[model samples]
Target: MAEFSVTLLIDASTSMTVTADTPEDAAELAMDEAGNPSLCHYCSGKMDVGDVYAARVYDGDKEVLDTDWTAQQLAAAEKQVEKLEKRVAELEQAEQDAVKVPRGLLECYLNGGGDWVEAGHKLRALLGGGE
Candidate 1:
């Protein structure tokens, strides 16, 4: 059996310290402590024993537990990022295509031709709005 220091956090402003042989024992102690009616330090309502959540455990200055996301979670996050990036790239391509003027319209605009009114309308439609 190893000595464990547990920090029991009931809410944002309430916490207590207790020592136990193991983290599990510490958690149990915390639950028991929270069940006590007098130990309700922050809330006016009755403290539910289920609300006694263990925030962290440590052995001296070193933390002995892992509370981070698992490898599967990290992999899923990476896949989501990839999917979002691909969607962004597709949207960027669509925006580029939308802004692209037809070669004939470009030539007509540059040449100052008689079909300027029709070319301007085509340009406005391609750009999604009129200037």
Candidate 2:
């Protein structure tokens, strides 16, 4: 395998309980208390998260693939989020529509090789359910 350089970034957050006069003082106090994190029980929400952000492939000191994976991944994630949100909204609307549809109609629709989801939308439209 060719040697590749990869960069990953992690962001960690730890909650600390400290008594201080100002925000700066609190930060300082937190650091001072950080020596023994286990001693603090009141602290909460300790989290560490990271994502692979970049990679580089080199050929004899010449850079070949220098890519910002972070940008690409973020764009992809945004698109997925958009799609998921739309799907969730559709499902929720269908759930509401299901309440309006008669059981017989739903049974017939399903038995006729119609998916419940599409059936919900079409049935709702025919039933004069506004939006």
Candidate with the greatest TM-score versus the true structure: 1
Cα miss at 34, model 1 (Å)?
32
Model 1 TM-score on a 0 to 1 scale: 0.34
lDDT of each: 0.63, 0.59
Once superposed on the true structure, which residue ranges of model 2 sit more than 4 Å away at CA?
A: 1-67, 102-131
- Residue-wise C-alpha lDDT for candidate 2, range 1-131, written one tens digit per residue: 79987655444445435566654465455555555333244433343334333333334465444355675687789999999999999999998867765874686488658877666666666767742
Candidate 1 clashes between residue pairs 3 or more apart in a chain or in different chains: none
lDDT of 1 by residue, 1-131 (tens): 89997755454323457889887676567667766434455654545334433444556676554233464476688999999999999999998876566664786577656578877876676566864
Clashes of 1: 0
User: How many residue pairs clash per model?
Assistant: 0, 0
The 10-residue segment of model 1 with minimum total lDDT is 46-55
Relative to the true structure, candidate 2 reaches a TM of: 0.30
